[model samples]
Target: MIDVKIFQTPSGEYTGFQMSGHAGYAEYGQDIVCAAVSALVINAINSIDQYTEDAFENSVDPDSGSVFFQITDRPVSTSSQLLLKSLVLGLNGIQDEYGKKHIKIRLEKQEG
Candidate 1:
């Protein structure tokens, strides 16, 4: 299953997100759930990089099928925030379609 954790600030703003694990719905190359999740996340990351000036930190652990991203040293810009929200929307759609065993999403709160 693909596990996605969205981090929210105390005031309920999205601070970042961490996604790990594979859907295992099918083989790696053919898993629709994996493809959908990857498309949503990668598109968001790319959009943030291209359209926003928010300084940030991001890392990927291939061995663990994990990716982590967080805005660093500053608040996220409007464009980045939009992209992040879009990502969550897409992820939720996937979860609804594929069900929990294939893709799971949870929210985590972070104190200021």
Candidate 2:
């Protein structure tokens, strides 16, 4: 299972999430799993724009297996919060056939 956390910062909001619980064959080719996970994350972030006007700037740390999403020069609103929740939950559904699972999301808002 993956654990996700979202937190707020002075600059912007961020989502910190991680995945675990893959053993044996599922653990053999982690690179592929990472790639798939990254893709799913990117897609979910992109989907947020459809629900809100805020544009998202994202970075994936392959080394730490963490993904960060920030709003670039946009006003944050209640809609943005809702969108964020939806985005994370959507990505959590992505799974691998090797018993590797992706789940959990943490979101934080940054104080201006």
Candidate 3:
């Protein structure tokens, strides 16, 4: 299963996210669940990089099916938060469709 954790403050602001593991819904190249998750994650990272002034740290490992992204800049920008929220929405939609057996979404509370 694909495990996605969204880090947020008690006030419901996004801080970071970590995604790991493969859905194994199908063969490597044919797993739609993995593809959807990857697309949302990569897009969010790229959007934050290109459109927002927010600084962040990220690591990606395709071989191990892991991706981690966190805002390094204090007080995440509105644009960055919006992009991350969009990502969460997309991920939730995928989870809703594929079920927890294939994808899992977890919200982790953080001290802001």
- Cα-based TM-score, every candidate: 0.93, 0.45, 0.97
| Alpha-carbon runs more than 4 Å astray in model 2 | 1-3, 8-25, 28-40, 49-53, 77-79, 91-112
Winning candidate number (lDDT): 3
RMSD of 3: 0.7
In candidate 3, what are the lDDT values of residues 10-40, reduced to their tens digit?
9899988998999999999999889889999
- Compute the lDDT for candidate 3: 0.93
| Model 2 lDDT per residue over 1-112, tens place | 4555555555654333334332222464555544555566566566666766766576666555656566664456667656655555555454324343344344546454
Candidate 1, superposed: residue stretches over 4 Å from native: none
Candidate with top TM-score is 3
- As for candidate 3, its clashing pairs are none
Residue by residue across 1-112, what tens digits does model 1's lDDT show?
A: 9999998887777868999999999986898888888888888888888888888789988677799988774466777778889999999988988899998999999864
Ranking by TM-score, best first? 3, 1, 2
Candidate no. 2 TM-score? 0.45
**Candidate 2 Cα lDDT to native:** 0.53
